[model samples]
Target chain A: MLAGFELIKIAFVGGLISLDSTVFGQFMLSRPIVAGPVIGWLCGDIKTGLLIGAMIELLWVGVVPVGVGVPPDSAIVCIVATAIAANKVPDAAAIAIIFSVPLGVIFKRLDIAHRKWNRVFLPVVENGIENGRYHILTFVIWLGVFLSFIKSFLFLFICVFLFNAILSYILPFIISAPALVKGLQVFMFVLPVLGLASFLASFVK
Target chain B: MKNCNIIRTFFRSLLLQAVWNFERMQNVGFLYSIMPCLKEIYVTDENRLKNAAMRHFDFFNTHPYIANTIIALTLVLENETVAPTGLPSVAASEETKSQQIKSLKLHLGGPIAALGDTFFWARIKPFCGLIAAGYVFIRGFNNIGYFLIPSLIFIFLYNMPHIFFRFFGFWLGLKYKTDVVKIISNFKIQKISEIIRLAGIFVCIFVLIAYIVSSGKYRFAGVLVFLASFILIKKNVSIISVFWGLVIGCVGAGFLM
Candidate 1:
C-alpha cells in the first residue's frame, strides 16, 4: 500500500540502481539476482523478486559490454518489472522478465542517446578543468544522477499504475500452458550456474 | 613543409583543431590525450589536414591504439625537416607538397586501423575481460564498495603494459620506418605468439581442472559441453551463440539433475 513520495523514492532507487549497469557502478552489481530480489524484498515479495531477477539474469547472460558493443540494461528490467509485479501478481516474476525485455531495450537506446549528448559535455568539461572550474565534473555527474532518478521514477510510476490496472482485468483473458511456465521457472534457477561456468571458462587459460 | 610553411601549418592546424568526443566506451580519457596532438596536426588547414583528421576520428573511435600510432607517425612525417635545425631552407621538394601528405594519409589510414583493432581491441581487451571476470569470481562480489578496487586493479594490470606497447610501437615505427619490411620478414609467427598462446592454454587447463576438482557435483557431460563451447569461443564463435546455447543446455540439464 505504498504510494506517492515513498513510491517515488523506491523508483528513484531503481533508477540509481540501474545506472550501475553503465557508468558509476560495478557492471556486475546491476545483475538481476541482486537488484531485483533486493528491490522485491523491499516491496514485500521475496520469491517474485528472486524469480524475476533470475530469469532476466540468464537470458541476458551473453550481453557483456565488450569493445563498442553496449549491452542491454538489465537494471531497468529488474527495477520496473520487480516494482510493478511485486505490487500486482505476487508470483509473476517469470512474466515480468519476459515483459521487461522490451523496456530494457528502450532504456538501452536512451542510454545510447545519453552517450551522444555526453559528447557536447566533453569540451565543457575540458574547459572547466582548464579554467579551474574543477566542480564541473561533480556537477555533471550529479546532474546525470538527478535526471536518472527522475526518469526512472516517472517510468516506474507510469508503468506500474497503467500495467497493473490493465493486467488485473486482462491476465485471465490470455492463456498460457502451466507446463511452459514451470519449464521457464526451472530454467531460471539453472541458467546462472551455466553462465558463471561459461564466463569462468573464458579465462581458463 | 618548408620551415615557414611548417610553422604556418602548425599554427593553422592548432586553430582548426576539432576534438573528436563520444560517450560510448567511456574512453573520454583516451581521447583527451590525443586532442592536443590533433590541434597541432589537423585543425588549421581546411583543404589539406581537415579531411584526414576527420577520417582519423572515424577510425579512432573504432581503433584507438592503431589510430594513435598512425597519427603520431603523420605528425612526425609532416613536421620532421630534412634541413639542419637552423639552416636556411631550400625551395620545397615534390615530396613536401600538401597533396602528397594527403595521399600518405589516405594510404596509412586502413593499415593503422587494422593494426589497432587487431592488437588492442581483438587481442588485449578480451584477455583483460576474461582475467577480470575470473578474478572477481574467485575473489567474490561481497562488500560491494571494494568491487571497484578489483576492477581497477584488473584494468591497470591489463592496460598499463598496453600503453607501453603502444608507445613502443610508435617510437619504433618512427625510428625504423625504413626497416619495416625487413623487420616484418624476420617476424616468426610461431616463435613467440605460439609460445604465449600455449602458455595461456596450459594455464586455462590447469584452472579448469582445479575448478572441476573443487566442484564435487560437476558432471562430465556438462563439463565437456562447456569445454567445447569454450573452444568454439576461443576459435572466434559468436558470443551470443555460445551464450544462448549454454542457457538452453543448462535448462535441459536442470530437468535431469
Candidate 2:
C-alpha cells in the first residue's frame, strides 16, 4: 500500500491526466490503459495497474466523446482504483475497482458543473474584447485549464481517502469469506468480456 | 498569414475546448486560436477587429481537429475581403462579406463536426486505444517497467495522424479556401475510419479469445458475461448501471451459493 504522502502525489498526477480528455489535449493520457499502469508503477505495483487499466479500457473501448456526450470518467477509475489497490492483495484490488467505478460517475457530474461554471469566463472574454484588453484571453484560457486541474485534484484527493477508508473496513470481511473472494475474482476475470460487448455495440450504433 | 501566426494558431487550436460552455460551446477557443490573424486583418481599424472578435463570441462548436480547416477557410475569406494595403474598401457590401464568413462558419461547424466525430473520435482514436489494449492483454508484460510499451505505441500512432492532419488540414484550408470542403470530402475520411474500425473489431475479438483461453476455470463465465453485456447494451441500458449491477450480482451470487 502507498503511504499518505505518496497518495497525494498520485492525486496530483491524476489531476493532470484528467485534463487530457476535453480540457486541453485529448491526448488519451487519461485513458485507463495508460493512466492505470502509470499510476500502478507509481504505487510500486505494475501488474495491478496494468490489470485494472486494461479492463477499464476495454469496457469503454468503443465509447467516444461525440458531440456533448460525456462518457464515464474511466481515468478516475484507473487512477483511484490502481492507486488504492496497488501492492494490496489481488482481491482487494478487485474491491477497489468496484468502488472506484462509481467515482467516475461522480466525477462526471462535477465535470458538467465545471463546464457550466465556465460560462462565467465567456462574459469575462466579452468584457475583455469590449474593453480592448486582449491579454485577458490568454489569462482566462489558462485559468480554465488551471481550474480543471483543481477540480480533478480535489476529487482525487477526496475519493482516495474515502474509498481507502471504506475498502479498509470491508476488505477484512470479504477476505474471510471464501465465497465473496471467489466471486470478486471471477468478476475481475470476466469484466473484459463485458467491455467487448459494449465495444461491439458501439460499432452497431 | 505569417508562419509565426500560423504556428501560433496551430498550437492554440490544441486548447480548443479549454473554456467550453453550453451557451456558446467552443466559441472562445475558436476565437482565441484565430486571434493572431484577426489582429493582422483588422490592424488598421480597432473597431473592425472588435466587431470581428465579438462576432466570433457567438455560438460555435465543432470537432477540434476539423476546426483547423474551418479556421483556415475564415483566414482566406477575411483576407480576400480586406482592401489591399491603403484602399478604404466599400463599407456597404462589406457587411455582406463578413456575413458570408459568418454563414459559412455556421454551416460548416455542425456537419464537419459530425464527420470528424465519425472519422477521428469514432474510429481513429479507438483503433489506437484498441491496439494498445490488445498489446497489454496479449503480451502480458514480464517486466513491470515495460508496461509503458503499450502507452507509447498508442501515443506515437495516434499523434502521427493527429499532428499530420492538424497542420496539413490547416494548410489545405489555406490553399483551397472555399473549395477546401471539396478537398476534404475527396479524402474519404469516413471510409478510412471504416477500415480502421474493422481492424479494431478483429483486434477486439482476438483479445477476447486470448482472455477466454487463459481464463481456464472462468472461461464459461467469461463467455456468458460477454453475451449478457452485448445484449444489455443493445437494448440501450446505460453502461454504468450494467457495470454496477454486475458487481452487486457477482457478490450476491457468491453468498447465495
Candidate 3:
C-alpha cells in the first residue's frame, strides 16, 4: 500500500534501525522483539506486530551479539517476517518464526557484504571528515540507510506476496487438522521458559 | 596530633573512583593512592589541576573498587598533622612499622578492587547466577530475585578473603619476586586465570544442558536448538545467543501457554 516516496522513507527508517545494531546507536533497537513490533506498528497493525514480536522474541532470546559473534539475520528476521505476518495472517505468530530462520541466515550474509562495502567507502568517509564536508559523511550514512531499506522492502515485498500465495495453497490443509493445530499451540507454550534459562545464563560472568 | 580534613580525603577518593579505568589493571591504584597528596602538597598550579585531571584520565573511566582504596591511603599519608613532630629518628620500632603496615593495607584501595573484581564479580557471581538458574528451573519465575541473596552472601565471603590475600600477594610479589620465582619456577598467575576459564566452561556446559532438558520441545525449540547448535557446531558463542534465544523462546511460550 506504500507509495513511491513513502517506500524511500520506510527504507530510511529501516536503515536507521538496522545501523543502530552496529554503531552510532544504542544497539537496543537491533533485537528482533523490539525491532519487529516497532516496525509492524509503523506499518499499521500493532496487534499483529506484537504477536510476531513476541514469537520472535522467545525463539531468539539466546541470540546476543558480543565480541564479533553475529547471530543469524536478526534484523530481517524481525523486520521482513513481521511485516509479512502483520499484513497477512492477523495471528500468524508460529508461521512467521519458522519462515524467518532461513531468511535470517541470508540477511547475515548481506550484513557481511555491507560491512565490506563500508571498508571500501572508508577513504571517502575519512576525506569527508578531514575536509569538513559533513554532507559527505551524511551521504555515506544515508546511502547505507537507503540500501538497507531497499533490501528490507524488496525482501518483505516478495515475502508478503509469496506468503499470500502459499497460505492460499495451504490454509485448507491447516484448517482440516485439529491435532496439528493443538500441537502447534503446545509447542509455542514451552518455548519461553527455555528462553528464560538461556537468557539468565548469559549474564553469568 | 590532629589530621588533614577527612572530607578532603574522602572527596579525593571519590574523584579517583570516577576516573578509574581497568585497562592497565593496578597502575591507577598506585597512581591514585598518591593523587590526594599530589594535589594537596605538590601540584599547586590551578591549570595543572585540569591537566592532571586529563593526564590521569584513566582514573575516571576504570573500575571503581580498586581505585578508591589506593586513593584512601594517599590521603592518609599526606595528612601533615599526622606527621611526627620530633627530630628525624634513625630507626623506627617494630611495633610502629607493623602499625604503619596495617594502616597502609586498610587505606590502600588497589587490593580491594582487584579482589572485588576477581573473586566477587568474576568467580562467585557466576556461581550465584548458576544457583539462580537452578532455583528458577526448580521453583519458578514469580520470585527469581530472591536468588540474589546467596550471590550477595557469596560476594561478602569471597571478597573479604580475596582482598586480604591479594594484599598479602602484592607484598609477597614485591618482597619475594626472586625467591618466589625460584620456589615455583615458570609460575605465571595467568595460569590460574586459565583454570578459572576452564571452570567457567564446565559450568557453561552444565547449565546449557540443564536449560535444554528443562525447556523440552517447546515451539521455540527451533530457536533454542539453533543457538545451541550454533555454539556447539560453530565452536563460537556469545551474548547474542542469549538475546535471540530469549526473544524467540518467550514469544513462543506466550503464544502456546
Per-candidate iRMSD: 9.1, 1.6, 12.4
Query: Which scores better on TM-score, 2 or 3?
Result: 2
Q: Which ten residues in a row have the lowest lDDT in candidate 3 chain B?
A: B17-26
True contacts kept of each: 0.10, 0.71, 0.01
| CAPRI tier for the interface of model 1 | incorrect
lDDT string for model 3 (B55-103, tens) is 3323222223333333443334333323444646513432353355345
lDDT per residue, candidate 2, B52-149, as tens digits?
Answer: 89987888899887889988998888877776544455775678888999999999999999988888788877777777877776676564357778
Candidate 1, residue A15: Cα displacement in angstroms equals: 12
Ranking by lDDT: 2, 1, 3
After superposition, the stretches of candidate 2 with alpha carbons farther than 4 Å from their true spots are B85-89, B141-145
lDDT of each: 0.50, 0.84, 0.46
The CA lDDT at A56 in model 2 is 83
Q: Which stretches of candidate 1 lie over 4 Å from their true place?
A: A1-205, B1-62, B80-96, B138-149, B169-192, B227-237, B255-257
Cand. 1 TM to true fold:
0.49
Best prediction by lDDT: 2
Model 2: per-residue Cα lDDT at residue A61 = 76
RMSD of 3: 14.0
Best-to-worst DockQ order: 2, 1, 3
Error of 2 at B178 (Å): 1.6
Residue pairs whose backbone atoms clash in candidate 2: none
- In model 1, the Cα lDDT at residue A38 comes to 69
